[model samples]
Target: MKKKICVIFGGESTEYEISLRSAASIINELDKEKYDIMTVGITRGGKWKEYTGKVENIICDRWYDDSLKDVSVDLGGADGALIVYGNGKLEKVKIDCAFLGLHGANGEDGTVQGMLKLAHIPYTGPDMLTSCLGMDKAYTKIMLESAGIDQAKWVTVNDYDRDEIMKKVVDAEEIFGYPMFVKPANAGSSIGIGKAKNRDELMSAIDNAFKFDRRIIIEEFLSGREVECAVMGKRGVVRVSCVGEIKAANEFYDYEAKYSDKVESKLIIPAEFKDGIEKRIKETAKKAFIALDGKGYSRVDFFVNEDDGTVKLNEINTLPGFTSISMFPKLFMHEGFSYAEILDRLIEIGME
Candidate 1:
């Protein structure tokens, strides 16, 4: 029997558009001979709909239509099912597994995973705790620190009041000195990330970051080569792919530089590294994945200090982008897996 695969995307997160593109890419690559595919889109307003539209519509932000059926997951039954109800009609669609093409916030950070768990449906990516930890930069850092993984020095802020935020900013300035990077603890695709070279920029950066998440993280700016490695499989038996480097068109790899077609961002596969640095990076990547008790797959980022070759762990993306230009699939492609093959492996692991 063909496996019934539901590719869930279009989350309420800031990375919603990226999720659409990622889901379309995955849906296009999935073997029609081996699987029965379904697409579920979550609107920005948090409505779940079963999208029966062209993949092109997903890419062009035209997937939403009146034809879409209002949907919900069946958490009350033993059989894993998706409940589609509209116009006084009800239907149940059995899902063998869910390919979570979601990024950031509600979908990626454990909300959807918790629902799938309650429904007893196996889904791609890590479990609820791991997803929550991986989505929150503060928790990721805490986990990495406990594992003794080398990373940049950082601090987290949770207070929303302007006076309290400014005090925290002063403390951060004293600790990290001049230039620093501020980002939301729970955002992705560089949605609310900024670099502040002075106190005014720092305050502005904090204010902007808090707009996306209640908590924000500030890290000391480290000048290094931006590199990343793709990891897969469950904890203690993970596979690390060859590294890739990102050459951002802007000062940093922000949301626009990451997704916009107008900007020219270059990605170098098998990114050049000196001597044993690549090996160390791959090792660190595995360590970071294991630290999160990662499952299915993730993309681990890092910064390789050009002057000293120090590899500082950056972050782990549990549900990395699956777009044509995404680093995760591309890095695995360099490691001898085709895009479809990568999906096959992920689905197989997710089922397990």
Candidate 2:
């Protein structure tokens, strides 16, 4: 019997469109001969729908309108049919496993993962605890710092009011000075993220960040080449991909530079490094993965100074983007694994 695979994408998160593209990419790559595919999409308003249509529509954002049925992942009563209800009709669809291509908040932050766990369903990406750790930038930084991992200077703030936030920003300025990076602790694709050079920009950035999440992270801007490494594994055995570099089109790799076609971003495979730097980064990437008790696949990002080869871990992506131009797949491609092969490995490990 062909395995029934559920590819869940789109979410109430800021990275909703990105998830659609990622789900399309995975759906296109999965071999039709080995699996029966069901595409599930979550709207920006948190509506769950079952979309059985052209993969192109999913990628182009047209599937959102042509969605056929409303759906829910039924975790409470599991009789093999994991998804229930559609088009106002009661329907039960048994799912063998799920490939979560979601990025940012709710979906990537352990809510869906916990649901799957309770449903006794196997799903791709990290487990619930690891997902929470990876999605919350402040917690990830704290855990990694506790493990002695090198990271950028940062401060975490949770006050919702503008006045309270400004006071926290004042404290941040005293420590990190100007040109700070402000980001929502739980957002992705650079949404609700900004660079502040002074008090006005700082205030503006904080307000923008609070729009997406109550928790915000402020960090000192580190001048270096943006490098990333992809990791795959479960249990104790982890494989690290070759380091890749990013050249952003904007002041930094913001939302526009990440998704817009007009604003181009360059990706350099097998990023050049001094004798020990590459090995160190690869090792650090693995250690960071293990330190966080990561399960399934993850992508660890970093900042590397070209002049002195200083390395600072940026963040961990439990469910990294798998779009055509995403670095996760590109990094592994350089190591001789095709995109399909990478997906196969992820599925196999996720089921294990």
Candidate 3:
């Protein structure tokens, strides 16, 4: 019998829609001849529903109606599905492995991973510790710095310091200077990112950022080329895809640029760069992946200062965008791996 792979997407995250797109990409690429595919959708409100149609159909158009299903597991029950309160009835669905496509909080931050671990189900992507570490910018930065990796200077803010946050903002300016990037420390797709060119912008950005996350981070913006590398694991060996460059039409690569067509963001596979710089970036990306104890697959982003040739680690997406046009898949595709092949490889490695 074919193994059932549950591709989970959506959550209480700003990237919920993007997660849907990512799941669609994964579902399209999964080999139906080898494995049985099950698409599960988690709404922004945290409700879980089993998608009836194929992933592509659901992504191209919202095909699945709200099932009003609530996914829950009982410790007393076996590893199979316990109950899903939907259609005014309780249902059970068996899942062999989960191909996680959920991004941002409650999903990518290790919560779902922990749940799956407890349920004794095999899931794709990083384990709990790595997922948690990758979600928090502050923790990831500290770990990267300790590993001798370069990153932008930054300051963190939490809810308790609302009154004192202004003072901390001023201090951040002194340390990282103006033209800073204020963002929710744990958000992805640049959901709550703002560029602050002055004190007013800085304060406003901080407030806006706090709206998304209780903890925020202010980092010095580096004027440089943005590049990303995709890494995949086979057994204990990790291989890096050819680097890709991102050219965004917006002030920065924000949600619009990422998901919508409003902003043009081009991807140049095997990005043209000085041989030495390219080598360094590829090496640094692999090192960053290992430092975070990442597994299955991940995308490591970086900012390279062309003037002095300094490269700074931006962040890592444990669960990156997987659309055909998305950077991670594009990188691997350019490196001669078809989309279906990439998905198969991920599932195979995950089986280990």
Candidate 4:
């Protein structure tokens, strides 16, 4: 029997457009022979609808064209089903599992995971607590600290008071000096991230970052090569993939450098590093994932100081991107898993 799979995409997230692209890619690769596919799209305003349009429409941003039926997970029921109501009728669509093609905000920060947990639906990626911990950079730093993981020095700003913000700015400057990275504590895909070299730029970056979330993270810039590793599987049985490096065309790997076609970015898989550096990074990747109680999959990033070969842990992305240039799949594909095979393994893990 073919299993019915619900591919959930989009959300009230800054990465909504990226989510659509990732969904389109996954929907295209899902084997039609073994699973029945269903797509649900959430609009920027948080409206949920059952999309029956062609997959290409999703990438073209036309998936919302025409009338689409209102759809929602049946949270009140024990069965893993979605309720679609429109045209004076209600239909129940049972799903065996859900592919969470979502990023940032309510979708990746455990909101959608909580809903699926209530609906008794198994979904790809981490559970509620893990998702919450992974999405919030402040909390992720806390977890990493507790695990004895070495990351860049950072200060978290949660207070919105003018005086408090200024105080933090002063403290950040005194501690880390200039040229810092400011990012929203709860955003991903490089959204709401700014690099500031002076005090004026730092203030502007903080203000702009706070616009995306109530809290923000300020970190001293670390000069090194940006490398990443892909991890999957549940606790006690995790798997790690080859490391990859990013050579951003922009001043840094901002959103544009990551996704824009106009910008030139280079991705080096099986990144060349000194002996034992790659092995140590892979080991740290597994350690960090297990420390966070990560499940399903994640991409752990790091910064390698080329001079002394010191590795500093970067953030862990619980639901990494699936876009054409995404490193998650590319790293695994280098390990001999086809895109479809990767999705298959994730689904199987979610079911288990």
Q: Specify the highest-lDDT model's number.
A: 4
Query: Clashing residue pairs, candidate 2?
Result: none
Candidate 1: residue 351 lDDT (0-100): 88
lDDT preference between candidates 1 and 3, better one: 1
- What are the per-model C-alpha RMSD values against the true structure? 1.1, 1.7, 2.0, 1.0
lDDT of 3 by residue, 1-352 (tens): 8888888888889888788888887887788898888777777777677776755665764755754356665344567443556667876667777898888999999998888877777788899999999998888988998999999999888889888877888789789898999989889989999999999998899889989998988998988999999999833589998889989878788888777876678877888887489889989989999998889899999998768989888999998888767898889888899898988888877767
| Clashing residue pairs, backbone N/CA/C < 3 A, model 3 | none
Model 2 clashing-pair count: 0
- Candidate 4 accuracy as TM-score: 0.98
Higher-TM-score candidate among 3 and 4? Answer: 4
- Point out where model 3 deviates above 4 Å: 54-57, 64-70, 74-92, 234-236
Q: How far in Å is the alpha carbon of 96 misplaced in model 1?
A: 0.5
Query: What's the CA error at residue 65 for candidate 1, in Å?
Result: 1.4
Q: How many residue pairs clash (N, CA or C atoms closer than 3 angstroms) in each of the candidate models, in the order given?
A: 0, 0, 0, 0
TM-score for each candidate, following the candidate numbering: 0.98, 0.95, 0.94, 0.98
lDDT of each: 0.91, 0.88, 0.84, 0.93
Provide the global lDDT of candidate 1 against the true structure: 0.91
Native-to-model Cα distance after best TM-score fit, residue 195 in candidate 3, in Å: 0.2
Candidate 2: tens digits of C-alpha lDDT, residues 283-334: 9999899998998888899998868778899989999999999999999999
lDDT of candidate 1 at residue 140, scale 0 to 100: 94
Off by over 4 Å in 1: 160-162
* Cand. 1 TM to true fold: 0.98
Q: Is candidate 1 or candidate 3 better by TM-score?
A: 1
